[model samples]
Target chain A: AQTVTQSQPEMSVQEAETVTLSCTYDTSESDYYLFWYKQPPSRQMILVIRQEAYKQQNATENRFSVNFQKAAKSFSLKISDSQLGDAAMYFCAYIPNFGNEKLTFGTGTRLTIIP
Target chain B: DVKVTQSSRYLVKRTGEKVFLECVQDMDHENMFWYRQDPGLGLRLIYFSYDVKMKEKGDIPEGYSVSREKKERFSLILESASTNQTSMYLCASSLVTGGWYNEQFFGPGTRLTVL
Candidate 1:
């Protein structure tokens, strides 16, 4: 079974600054997908960024980027130019290339945007 | 835009009560998932359906059953609710293209409390 770990339970970043949330996973599969999801208070959860294990380049989406280290089995999310909208619970997820594509999520990190 | 809606935003039930949580998705997605979120545990998949009338148990399917008579709707049922079942329930949908899974869109979670 694959397991994702997010050690930080809470993180805070000042407005317009940058914050990084750490994540690591245990997986024997060489090919898989990793994802970061954000869930705001009483709002829908949305995808932040995704990284493919086979792709060496990290994935970037707007102000959100991921540091995917396949060799170290680490995948961290970096939020730049942080805004108030970034305050939410961030989750790291893993899914293999095969099977039912069920996601295994880490214990979330609650991000607070300090203004 | 893809939209997944749950039947209730909040629910309170008594122990031994039969509870049903309904989820409906738009955009004709082929896969729908049910998950429970806790404080220290991110999201644990309870069940998922790939097609109409076809359902699969996820990582944490114990004490839960699912029904998917239609492609757009999936229902999670707790035959006898317990205090341990109190948690936030989330519904998500994703597309399967060429045997690969796409990004999942989530609904505003339902917070259920069992007394």
Candidate 2:
């Protein structure tokens, strides 16, 4: 069984500034995948970034990046140059390498971008 | 672009009524999942199918059942709608790359209200 945790229930970031959303997971598997998903007010869940356990390098999208520490089971999402469009509910998710590809998600963190 | 579509954006059903939620994916992915999103509980997986007729129970499956009769379509069924089951239901699909490294694409969730 796997569980993901996002400590921050709500986060606020000023436009053009940077913000980090914390996430931690407990998994027994050595190889798995971590993902960060953003759900805006439109109610669509968009993939922000993904990180593989074997790869030490964190994943980075245009304005989204992750700090994945395999040892600590921490995979925090960093939003750089935060924009108004970034305001959403962010979820940290996990998927193991085998069996069904069901995702285990953490309690979301609602992010508010302030101008 | 990978497009996952759900049948309804919002639905209202009376308690004890049978409910059906449909999902379709255009990307021909081999995996589909059903999840419910509550305010503080995040996304809890109800069911997932790796292939047609192959289904697996997820963390929270007592109140839901699923069907994957085709590669691109999946359905979630509520035998009897209950107030506690009212929430945002999400459908997601992913290409199976033989493991868990595949990325999942989500649909604009279906908001179900049981009255």
Q: List the pairs of residues colliding in candidate 2.
A: none
How much lDDT does each candidate structure score?
0.92, 0.91
Instruction: Give the number of colliding residue pairs in candidate 1.
Output: 0
Task: Pick out the ten consecutive residues of candidate 1 chain A with the lowest summed lDDT.
Answer: A95-104
Q: Each candidate: RMSD to true structure?
A: 1.4, 1.3
Isolated chain A: TM-score per model?
0.98, 0.97
lDDT string for model 2 (A24-93, tens) is 9999899888989999997689888888899998899998899999999999999999999999999998
Looking at model 1, give its docking quality level.
medium
| DockQ result, candidate 2 | 0.64
Model 2 CA lDDT for position A26: 99
* Best model number under DockQ: 2
lDDT of 1 by residue, B1-115 (tens): 9989999999999999999999999899999999999999889899988899998898889999999998899999999999999999999999972233568899888999999
* Local lDDT at B43 for model 2: 93
- What local lDDT does model 2 show for residue B55? 93
lDDT by residue (tens digit), candidate 1, A12-81: 9999999999999999999899999999988999988888888999999999999999999999999999
Candidate 2 CA-lDDT value: 0.91
